[model samples]
Target chain A: MNPEQLNSPNDFQTIVNKIYQNEQFDFVGIALQSSEAPHSIKWDFVAGNTNERFRKIVLRSGIGIAGLVVRTGKPFWDNNLNHYEFSDEMYTPIAKTESLRSAVAIPIISPLTNLVRGVLLAGYRSNKIKISGQTALTLSQYL
Target chain B: MLETTRWINNYFNDSTDAIMIFKDDELILSNQIAKDLQNELELNPQYLVEVADSSVKQKFSPTDNCFSCIIQNKMKEISIPITLAKNMPHPLNYFMIYNVIDQNEKVFSLTLKNRGTIDRMDQLAQQRKLTQYVNRAHEKERKRISEDLHDSIAQGVYSAIMGVRRLENNHFTAEEIKELTTVIESQLNDTLTEVKEMALDIRPSVLDNFGLLAALKVLAKRLEENSGVTINVAGNANTEHLSDDIQSVLYRITQESINNALKHANADEITVLLVAHNHYITLEIMDDGDGFDVPKYQHFNGKSMGLMNMNERVKTFNGAFKMESKSGEGTTITVKFPVA
Candidate 1:
């Protein structure tokens, strides 16, 4: 499915597949917030995942990669993850399960209200991947 | 106040130190501690602004503030001295202030922490942590001793009692009765030996009567016989010039090390060297067994707390302790103390 065809939750997987096929990423995922009180975020669509454990990851705002992007409405990524503590509870819920050493996440904002509604993540399994602002800008173009 | 930020106000208001919040030069909220300071210094709300040093003022301003970016800067800051209208009970009035000013939210807070109060709080926190570690180590020891009594000593004695009762109720030949009596006698003897070993564990009387060398040698011989391992103890720590406390500490450290080697290391041979020169004593224990990661177990580990407990004991007696270990290699512990 193309970006213009993202009318249903099932279509989100095609967008993830589109990004994964067009990029040099090992994994591509989309996480969206629920429209309710105590709005939590979950991985709605993913491509090239090693396992289905990402479906079990539910994060609050300002927590993991997706949650942080939704909370701060800023692009987030770790260029060098050599010293990143995998056992830290803050990021381990997704990073450990997916074995992701580095990732870049960008917010998807609703143009009308200027509020972040979802996040798009492109990541690699190797720690040596150096994701920069140019890389985040490249990923944001897909959103 | 915005409903979203009401919780921050409530949280800061419950602090034990002086905290005052400002919104566009208007005093919005003040905690009880801040009210007390205002009364004692005869100060107005403006004091929070003027009391801050120029060095701190350069940090950030409330309007168009980006202070949150640098909020976690290093501490070790100089105290802000205050000249007050009224005299305080302290010899000098000084504060170490922590400020959080948010221009976007249009609310800023300044918390004036008394230098003396901060020092007292740091000392109390350290004492609390130390008390908890010591209590945990103490409780672990008590559990081990209880397990020994219940599993080995109590069970042995119970079985011997049952054997004696069976001998009374059975109709047997005189020869069989003699053999049974002998068996019961040996069982009681073994229980007696276990009781003696436990008493020795508590505090060996040899340590008081014959001094450190005799105590360590006797301990080594008994452990060698029980564990079927060779333990070599060669030390001339001549206990004459030492006080009773120093002697006991040395004995306890050595005992604990050997026990660790036998139980955890699975070592076949161990060596202990204790030497006392003119003004200092050095003790070293080495074992040929599997060693573990030192830094990993140096923290609050219940099963392997012997290292930290021994280190604490040595430090209490004004001694230096050093430990070296490597996986598949062996463990070595050295302790040194200055003598008078």
Candidate 2:
């Protein structure tokens, strides 16, 4: 499609929603480090039947699940928040807001400079899940 | 007199109390009490003599050396009340001696009581002491295990994730390989999340790093997200100022309370308030969920250690813990501790 077609938040959300339509995933969203808003990472686009709470969450770098992945340049995931333990303060806000039982976030890097500038977040509300290599590559491909 | 003497001899033979007669610093008459009491001292006989000299002479009086005799002695009795020294085996006793002239100034002496019970009780208390030591060792072990997982294992997982990213740069074809790579990525992502969650649950880095406010806020947010319950949390206390140990206790207690509410109480709304007033920090968790009879589920049986565990944490800081609930109302747990 046109590059301008993917320019807006709705467009991004529409595209992501179509991609994961048949998948078992519960929610799929994209977060980019916003230069317009404090230069920290924020969830710019979200798709799927999401709670109104997600809209109010303006994430900082290393603050929530997406923020941690984007800031640390690493992918993070957990199936059960209650069962799995985390020591960092960064993920607490994300864990609380999303009610995400099992979820993963992979850092998305620029294809040219290989510089991580965003993250792809996918999660399920049921059991704990582990993101495999193939799923990680698929996520990278989409980005 | 002979019959009495025989009974005295028999009784004295088995008794552990010191029974002796002294004549001019000579042990003229000694019973099993002497052997028992002497062995219990665990000190040089010379020390006993010195102690006796210092005490007996000071308390001694001219005519009172007999039954009414006043013997100068500073050797005060050491006994744990509610228990007998000889019978309990926990205390050691002693008997001093002083010379008394019998009719012809023969330098005959009377025996002063000194009985010790420590050796007897040592054997009994050994098991108790051992169990206590083991419990302490186990507590330290738990802490160490939690720390190692947080520091080493969690860090290792993060590093491996970075290494996986390094592999992504390679040219990959074959739909199968690409698919396999995605699977690997998901597995790593899952593992990383699990590791982080484990570390946080055991001991949150926020509680360790920024303090209780940040941690509690995180906890409150989580309760809201998962249960679809709106948890409004507000705290005026300086959570960052609380001691790390206290912070952990509060964090754990809050965790258990929230978990219990989620699992048992089908509550729709929960509110947490933490405030510092008059040198005490107070935390209250109130839920408008389905409440239950407080006395019905009060036992700390094996099934649910939730309240029991929270009680233990509160007790560690000499704090007060109270929970209130009703069949149809809801449950509220309040914990308070001094700002030590």
Q: What are the TM-scores, per candidate, against the unseen true structure?
A: 0.47, 0.43
For candidate 1, the per-residue lDDT at B2 reads 95
- What is the C-alpha lDDT profile of model 1 across B1-340, one tens digit per residue? 6975888777767777677778775678889888887787677877556555354665554453555425523553424545344354555345645454776866666666666766788778866777887787689669867976885578668856876887879886776665455545544554666677778887898988898888889888776644445789998778778888878888888888887786667565789998998999998999988887889777644344577778888999899999999997889999999999
lDDT of each: 0.71, 0.62
Candidate 2 DockQ, CA atoms:
0.03
Query: What lDDT tens digits, residue by residue, belong to model 2 across residues A29-137?
Result: 7776553423334566766535555544445444455656755678777555544333234343344445567667888664433545567787776664566655655
Summarize candidate 2's per-residue lDDT along B1-340 as a digit string, tens digits.
9999999789877654555555555556667756665566543444444454544553554444543222223323311112114454565344444444463544443343433354556655754655665687579669866875765456546754764665576564564344434434433453455466556756688787777878888877755543445778888888766777888888888887877786667566778888998789999999877788876666544434567667767998899999999878999999999885
Best by lDDT: 1
**Model 2 CA deviation exceeding 4 Å by range:** A1-8, A20-24, A34-44, A55-104, A111-113, A125-132, B1-231, B234-269, B274-283, B288-306, B309-320, B325-330, B335-340
Question: How well does chain A score by TM in each candidate?
Answer: 0.84, 0.73
TM-score of chain B of each: 0.62, 0.49
Query: Which has the greatest DockQ?
Result: 2
**What 10-residue stretch in candidate 1 chain B is worst by lDDT?**
B69-78
